[model samples]
Target chain A: MNLISEPGAGALILRVQEERIDAAVAIQFKDRLRELTAGGEGPVILDLSQVTFVDSSGLGAIVGAMKLLAPSRPLELAAMTPNVARVFRLTRMDSVFRIHATAPETALHVRAAG
Target chain B: MCAPPDDAALMPAMAPADCSALRGGDDCFRRNFRAEPLAVRDALRAAVARFARRMGPDDAGTLELTLAEVLNNVVEHAYAGLGAGPIDLTLCHAGGRLHCRIEDHGHPMPRLAAMGRAMPATDVACTDLAEGGWGWALVRSLTEGLAYRREGDRNLLTFEFRPACR
Candidate 1:
């Protein structure tokens, strides 16, 4: 469950290093994402290009990470693989989160787009 | 040295049979796993990959997602407090349809009345998104024949997927 974090201009780009996010690492994924974004001041762009699959538990974990920073920081997803994106589309979570083609450089893009 | 006779000439000739006739019969797969989340995930990945090789990737993805939701539910709710237990999974494919039956002794199926089956509102703001309730909805949407029954101490859930429908 290695996550590479890079602080961009006004956003934190957290790239998940795993190929699959399923029941096995759902809890660990949420906990680690929470820790990484706890002190960040701006929007968070979650890079999921490496994640090829996501199950229901994994979807829940992503939503849980968002709730952990509700009413303040926002969590956006980017570069989801086709299989992973299908899960979001099937569950209609694509409507709930701001999904992007790729990780944006700054929080300004997120704010401007939102 | 003398050359060996041709293999095809050495054997008796046989007529070709219908491929559909062979595919029409049930092809069954069964496995039992410890009611642990990681084990469940690994088993599902392997099984789904095998299925994909046989039934194409699209149908396999649907099956994988639905089964993941069901098995994860079993691990999270059924075997929650109880120690490791055996979870039985059986799959049969025939006539362009796949049937899956899962059995567990840990807990009876939860009452639908208690746990609502409604799809979470997708129109809500990002800050107010609900995550946990979407599993069942996706299962119902992707599967054709879904049935659940608790017989004695066993919880049996059966679902069917018609790949052609997708």
Candidate 2:
């Protein structure tokens, strides 16, 4: 349940260090994210490159985290493993959140190059 | 003959057990666990990973996702209000398909008939997007021959999956 946080381009990039986020840690995951992002301003980029699996509870936890932000801050996802990404795609949560193929640093680089 | 033989003697005698090495048929695995949310994920992941390995990585991943969803439902709804109970799972591979059977004694299946068994609308605005209902939809979309039954005190759910290439 360790999350590495980095600030990038007016956004907080939080990378999950775990390999799987399922029912076991879904509640704790949401609680930790809420605690970390509390009173924080600007968008949050959740980097899921290390996550290989996410179940319904994990997905709900993510959505719950988004709702916790409400109208003020947005939550974006980045660098999802193929398996993790499939859960989002299959559930169609891909449409709800902005997704990036790489971390914000890489995304920022691409934007600068363009 | 005197007293029509003793009651125990009148009963059929147990047959002698054959002692030999049993040949494995279809691959089968079973596990029983307490209906607790925290333990459900780990148990399911390990079991699904073991069986899915035989199919392939892709199918394994799919199986993990679908099974997780179903097991979570059991933990959330089935065990809700009721105290912790035993959740039994059996996985078998035969006829070129993987069959999963889950049994629990917590609660009966809810009114899924009204749910329409269809994927929810994903085209809605971001604000209107749903988080929860997607579980069953994903399970339905990935697996085939999904069925549910309740017999007396137990609830049984069965589903099957073919290989990814199939």
Candidate 3:
């Protein structure tokens, strides 16, 4: 249930470090995303290359994340695995978010900040 | 469980054996677990392993997602008030389609007749976009021959999926 945050030049990126985001962790995922995106001004890009699967509950949590930032900060998706992308595409959330094949060119900010 | 199933996770889930020690024509898997998200996760994992050798990556992914939604529905909705109940999952891969039946002895799934008929209106404002209610839609969109029935005290939901031929 941990997400690695990378500082981006024009956006904020949070990478899910888990394999599956199913019913087991959907609530926590939503809460964590809210916590990370609370004060960020730019679009929050979710790096999902490591996410192997996402069920409907996970999908809902993602939508919740986007709605939480509504009208101001956008929650975008990037680097979706085949299964994870399919869920978003099937639910038509792909059209809602700015999806990137791979997370944009953000230098992987190391933990030297804190 | 309404009917006992030798959990695929526990036993040597190679081939299902019968009274005469005769194997069935198709590979079938049956697992019984507590109707909880974590148990559903474990069951989905076992089911994938059972059929992964015969399935491609895409089909495996589809089946896992579909089953996860169905099984999670049982956990989140079916047994909402009844704590944790037992969920019986039976999956048989035959005729190039994976058949799934999940049984749970919880509250009757309300509005059973109108399930998955329409996709939740995803075309909405960001604030109005639904956070939930997409489970049945995703289940219906990804699978075929979806049906649900409450037999006395148990809810039996059956569905099928045709895996794209590789």
Candidate 4:
């Protein structure tokens, strides 16, 4: 898994390149998140439009990162793939985070409003 | 492939009685393949996904992933180097639940439950992780129930899912 960063309009965009986000790559995914947040960024917009599938391990890593960030920073997901979206919906994680339909839209929301 | 004489003929006494059995029904489905692990994984995922949709979407992700990992294991280890043998998979959905069975003429039944122990200290990296270990860990977490046994040179793995009622 590769995490590429681009300065979105207001938020940092993370592009995930992988076919599946299962145990095989969950750790790397989490580590990248940690590396970014630890750099003292204000907020992040994850562009998951490229991720095709995610398993429990991947879900756990994401949830763990959210808890690690706590009330300090906000992490948002945008443009979920069908299989990835299914995991979020089935686990009810969709309700826990702000989900946008596209990467540009996610950055726009964070930039335009609060 | 031609439809069987009776859809139920594809699955004999081993099938759960609570559901309608068919060779090609959306509820019950079967496919045979030539012991290729990746192909088996695809077939398993497709069949399990169908079963989950027919059964309901509650925890369907878990069921589908579990079935794929389990059947993949069977394809890889069961017939590792054996000549050629058919791998049979049957899936059924009824009673608000989904069930899948995979049978292969591979080696004897393995100690799957015993191997579900937490990953050892040395297995943190991709190289150290054994082939069969992570797959079983996935199975342990995904299914509502599981059973493994050998029937006359055939290794049979049955997985059941009855997610909490919505």
Query: Which candidate's TM-score is highest?
Result: 3
What DockQ does each prediction reach against the true complex?
0.16, 0.14, 0.26, 0.06
DockQ, candidate no. 4: 0.06
Best by lDDT: 3
lDDT by residue (tens digit), candidate 2, B1-166? 0011122111112222222212234787788988887677767777876665466556777888887888888888888998778899888877667789999997897796722466666565545556677777787889898888899999999999766543
Candidate 4 per-residue C-alpha lDDT over B1-166 given as tens digits, one digit per residue, 9 for 90 to 100: 1111221111101122223222233367788886664465467567756655433443455566666566656655787788547888887666555667888899875665553565323213222322224456556666766788889989888877665442
How good is the docking of model 1, by CAPRI class? incorrect
Candidate 1 structure quality by residue, lDDT tens digits, A21-90: 8889988999899888877678788888788789878898998888786657777788877677778877
Local accuracy of candidate 4 as per-residue lDDT tens digits, A1-114: 687777776677777766666655677888887887686655576778777666656776776666566455567777776657765654445555667667764433453455
Report, for all candidates in order, the number of backbone clashes.
Answer: 0, 0, 0, 0
Using TM-score as the yardstick, the better of models 2 and 3 is 3
Tens digits of per-residue lDDT, candidate 1, B44-68, equal: 8777865666655556677888888
Query: Which stretches of model 3 miss by more than 4 angstroms?
Result: A109-114, B1-25
**Residues A5-98, model 3: lDDT tens digits:** 7788888889899998889999999888887777769878888878989988898888888888876877777778777777776776666676
The per-residue C-alpha lDDT of model 3 at residue B113 equals 50
Best by DockQ: 3
- The positional error of residue A33 in candidate 1, measured at the CA in angstroms, is 1.0
lDDT of 2 by residue, A18-110 (tens): 998888898889989998898889989898878988987888889888878766888888888778877877776666676766777734333
Candidate 4 segments exceeding 4 Å error = A1-48, A55-114, B1-26, B55-58, B83-85, B110-115, B119-132
Position A41, candidate 2: lDDT: 96
- Comparing 1 and 3 on DockQ, the stronger one: 3
